[model samples]
Target: MSALQEELILSSPYQEFEREEWKDLNGQFNLNLESTDIHSLHALNEPLNMKEIEEIYFPLAHLIELHIKNHDTIRDDSNSFFQRNQQKLPFIVGIAGSVAVGKSTTARVLTKVLSLLPHKPKVELVTTDGFLFSNKVLLEKNIMNRKGFPESYDTKKLLHFLSAIKSGIPQISVPMYSHLEYDILEDEEQKIIEPDILILEGINVLQVTSQKGQNNKVFVSDFFDFSIYVDALEKDIISWYVNRFESLRATAFQNPTSYFHKYADMSLLESREMATQIWNEINKPNLHDNILPTKYRADLILQKGSDHFVESIKVRKI
Candidate 1:
């Protein structure tokens, strides 16, 4: 056995399941998803199909529904014990992963499935991209190159938003981010209104970040009732990132207003070289330094194959 497998068996707090094993756990029926809906949920270069939903995400959605039920039960028990009628907080689900690892597709698919639960619960999906500093802010901070790094986010704002959600605040407005423009839209906001479950997806979701003078030791994951980390071999992730960049060059980057429009006219070789350089200089270091370290901290980890499909799942033992 590999040392990694041995270590997992010996001391890891997680129980691992191969893809087939995980699929067997999907004892669910009447999933209200169509091929059209599935297609709309996938991000650039990330494929989603009914087979994937049936074999992977259906079980995951059912598991999350179980968690939400438990969360409600606990709240009710706590209220009874305390003799206080406090409002129940939304069950926050955090999804974390490296760039181009299909976190967006996972979040969207899960959101759609959960909304169609037997209870027809309200499910809202939010990405931390909306919390990232705009191009202007990054340039002013002289960290434009560190775009996806922990430091490039408005940590205070994100925390405040999470706090509001847990506080049961209604109609919370989140900053809007445009992938085509590659920046935050100052005038636009996404309203999250009293969802029964909120899925927060981002590379930074599971990270341990603190403000310079933060007295409160609360981390982002503290707001999450359940957390997921999408994981893969670094080599595979780098290839995916490069491939996604190339795809964007052909599609989104061709727009004159795109932040990466300069690369749209580049030859195939030039685009590939640029993507590799960005990955090696920026995304790669961020993954190793900030994202990958938080993998074990997640309640669940989805290990992906080179083909960008989940190969295994590791669930933290309760």
Candidate 2:
């Protein structure tokens, strides 16, 4: 490819914002979150300070609020045009990223802030982890090593769940996944009852899984009113994964009931090596071949620097 072709290929339909510029967009809105609340929101090894909340997430929350309002307005207009009373569906937001990229914290903080908006919207969070096939099923399929891959997920069930929610069904129940147990909690379920907004976070929420020649194909993202992708360099993500693994080795992994309990006996260096090996073999491949390709599909992208703080944001121009 020539230089012109390369430039065109690299160009994106996004308006980029530096951290300082983005903070200004928050305006005079007061986020009523206390220090304790902020502390509670941080994921393992993911540093989220008030500075980040104020500068990065506050603006993001503001933008999502606008989208929600717009959705409501459009719904009202459509209902009036059709001369019918239509039930208002929940506004769904999807957050996607690679493992250890901090998308979970983003989803949690966004849910908290969006719920605290002036309208006090009821926000519910659901992770795609719940949709993963059980270990027994994976073993039967011989795809245990590809646990986070698309094939490991029950796409039909996930679609049904999202479809039921979109159809304005009440009292929808979703299975819950336990990180400690490393499997679905068969007895525990999350009840979502007519939430004003639903935030779905996972590594593959933005992925496209439809096969060719399939009529009326629907994807998980088709349910999203807005979407975000948390992004970072591969090296930084590997470092974060290793750091989190080491931290968990000293904590969650030590639990005898934990699926990763064996790792708890490993030394710091050994844990790091194991983490790196896992990332290289599993997460990295998934990130590059599956997750990263969907980054551009997000309505917004939060780009993190080596220090793990969001350095800039990219909003889709169209």
Candidate 3:
């Protein structure tokens, strides 16, 4: 091949755009979410406003719609070529980000918006937290302090659950987790019935864990038709974490049954100090060592500013 041809072929796979550039792609989708909807979906101290949703998330939802349609067509065409009768698989989308970076809120908003689409495809949201090992198991294993670490979860069960969904299983049940109680709920599960779209959101969703003692194994992203990573500076995320802790103190932590209820009575100064310490000791290490490393693996990235609005988007070229 000529030098010029080779150079063109090797152009960057990432095509990044400013927020406005991305928003103009579809030229404004009808803003279906309202104040009540935003209130319901927004996370504590997340700082999400409708302006950011209109300019950032709606466009993303539209792009995912296109991806879903393209995926369906490709499946149909391939199946026709082989004259095989098979169930259409679910379109899996993974949303990964650091703790308190608003990935959950992003997932919730997308689930609602996508459900409002013209096609109105059935959509469901699940978090990797649901697959985490119970606190009893963690205590037994002596990894209670390493709760958010990748090793803290039951990767085997998580793998099996997604495998069942992708294999077109009509019904699958995942374990449930309670943030207030801060433990996996015993004997309770979330039933996932064959949704057209599945939004799998969590801190470790993008992690590509190698299969131990095996060859040619797959990672979680292998099942995802599309994936997103929410991005922000480490400093900004730390600050946000502290703010969220303060907010939750007056809310979730105030409940007598809350695992963190002890923190409810702390002074504002003491609470902030404790939050900062925990971030540095636990969440910060997890983000840098495990979560942030998987950012580029996502099909798209939403880069958030310090104020928590999506300021830019990085799209991976086809």
Candidate 4:
């Protein structure tokens, strides 16, 4: 068989669209987000420009709005059929990707866009960093180097919190995490109070974890109304991570309170070498073994180019 035939047979279940094709769907929507808004929503050291937002995220937000409208209609019909009224639960959107892939920026942009819709629904953004095992716990368990892997998280607690949200609990409080400290804040929590939409952003949000001999556990993605996976080639991601590492050394890592402050004192060459080593030894393995495996489970996948622009989108084929 020809190589082209083999490639065709290996095509994904997702319906792929190039950037031009996807952005054309944004059509007459007044790209109302200003330059300042895009800058504020963007991540530090990530190249997210106004053009990228308008061409990529604006159309995605519009698509999500359509999905929410259809969901509401179906929900109303179900309620009417039962002759009963039930409290509306927030539509949960899970954003998953490799480290340095810009999932946080994507989540922030989506939250702002959804909240600014015609109905102006309440929107809240939460990250799964809070769901991770505290630094103390990791040290005790001797898994400090494996931090972003699934085993380093409090999976049961995360599951419980998500379950409460979907069960229509009036308010839920999640532990807060501090990037400056690179640890969970034992004394602080973020309260999410009855939002109209909840955007859960994290590296492992779409991952499925199960023991080798156990088959009874459900995954975190089961509760998601929608899920997004931010994707890029591994080589591009390594470059991005190294760039971010250097930037953080000059900025946040300089803070005495920063967990990575040790790197702040290192020379430029040393820092770059350490950054590449860490990425190769730790982050790359996690992406290959844990994160990338979950990409097909996403409702939508944003595939980014080496230049940090979203170049394609793959919506799961229903």
Candidate 5:
């Protein structure tokens, strides 16, 4: 291991174990988890299995649990010292990565696994899509092609949402976006109430920006107790994006009201060309300009092989 990797392991509260060692460690948990394996979390069409989850994700969850416990203890100690009544903030985890890198899947799986922990209370997963500007706003700004760009999102709204969650607010409402419609829904919302853990996933969660003659403030990453970046080769991610686009074309895009319905009847060759064009013109540039630059800010990086399996992990030392 490199010095960085060694430092990460030493600083972390959880023990690092190989894939085969997970079964032995299973008894350590009081809860009966269906499968701690990483592969089980991948989409049904994607190839994944238990061993990947054990070696890669389980350890990360253990570390998160430890961090939550330590945070609670410190909060209690501080409250006693100050003799004040303040609710402890929820442990927030941020997941960031380029599109098609499977960050969403990672966020969902982490939420499930963390919630299954014996001591965990309520785990809520929120995606940055909820904070994106309405399609009308993007259209008005003539930024429809740049929809996924950082400027296309309402950063102020996202910050306020995180602030609300971090303040231990009793209830919060998050807007819902529909990928099929390619816009925020009219009357849909997600309600979160007093979560113990909040998982926030987005393409630019770790992005940093500064205004003229002022220090940077309120980055999405500032609210995170821990952050993860899912990584893969640019070519691999582009290929995955194309594949996913084709899959969506066959299913969701076929819906008459779908934003992409126009592409539903295209030939396979035409679809491939369209997918490649979109990636090269839109998604890839956004990744380079807004997303990939934030990789170093992640507390942990999950590197995936060409086959889409997480082959290695890099945890930054505290």
Candidate 6:
């Protein structure tokens, strides 16, 4: 085993279980159970199956639970010494990955599984998509083509949201964005109050910017208690993106009010070409420049095969 792999195994809570044995244990868990499959929580149209949940997300949720318990104990001990009544901060998990790598599915599954845990009934999942610049702002900047790039998001607002959650604010409201409308709804927001675990899933959640001549300030990563990078081969991801775009063209994009409605009438070949152009010009570049570089920094890495199935997991040793 590589030194990094050895370190990961040693630090992981499930280190005692052999890989095969762990898979068996995970297989025993029926993800289809009424309590386990949360339809309301899923952001995507497709429903995740039990095997996918077991093979990929169950272990991750278990790790998060362990981290939360340990963090609470440490906080209590420190508070006891200081003789104060400060509540422990919520355990924040950052999920990062390239576009169309099934990260949204992974995030949703984690949210569902974590909430199912008896110890943590209140689990909130927030996507950084909400922090993206409004369509008006993007149009004004004339960078709508760079929608998923690092500069497309309002980093300051995202940082403040993380800060508030870290500070243990009683009630935190996060703005909601609609892909169909291609805009963030000003009035609608998701309310998270006293959540035991907070999952912040985004493409650039782990990005770190170094200011010249100053102590490096870790951006969103500083607030993360645990981080995960959902990974797959570049070619596979591109294929998935094109497939997803084709699927959306027939469905969401067909809506009269949808921003991408114009593409709905295009032929399959034309749609594929458009998808390829967008992926090559926008998403691929952003993934290479901003997202892939942060993969090594994750606490756990979930590696997926071409079929969108997680083949292996690598947890970083602390």
Highest-TM-score candidate: 1
Cα shift from native, residue 283, model 3 (Å): 0.9
Identify the candidate with maximal lDDT: 2
Clashes of each: 0, 0, 0, 0, 4, 0
For residues 108-176, what per-residue lDDT tens digits would candidate 1 score against the true structure? 988888888889889999999999998999999899989999889988899999999988898899999
Poorest stretch of ten by lDDT in candidate 1: 207-216
Q: Give the worst 10-residue stretch by lDDT in candidate 2.
A: 208-217
Instruction: Please give the range of 10 consecutive residues that has the lowest summed lDDT in model 3.
Output: 209-218
Candidate 5 has a TM-score of 0.88
Candidate 5: tens digits of C-alpha lDDT, residues 1-318: 899998976777433333344434444544334655444566633565655555556677887787888898999999999999778788999999999999888887788778888765799999999899999999998888898898889888888999998887889999999987889986999999889999999998999864234365778888999998999999999888888888888988999999999999988899999999999999989999889998888888887888887766666655
Candidate 4 per-residue lDDT over residues 1-318, each given as its tens digit: 999987875676778899999998885554477778878888877877778878887789888888888888888999999988877889999999999998988999889888887788999999999999999999998999999998888888888999999999989999999999999999999999999999999998888777344463778899899999999998898999998999999999999989999999888898899999999899999999999999888999999999888999999877
Write candidate 2's Cα lDDT for 233-271 as tens digits: 988998899999999999999999999998989988899
Better of 1 and 6 by lDDT: 1
TM-score order of candidates, best first? 1, 2, 4, 3, 6, 5
Runs off by more than 4 Å, candidate 3: 1-11, 211-216
The models' CA-based lDDT, in order, is 0.89, 0.90, 0.89, 0.89, 0.82, 0.81
Identify the runs in model 5 with alpha carbons over 4 angstroms from their true place. 1-27, 30-41, 210-216
Clashes of 2: 0
Q: How much does candidate 1 score in TM-score?
A: 0.95
RMSD per model, one decimal: 1.7, 2.4, 3.6, 2.0, 4.0, 3.8
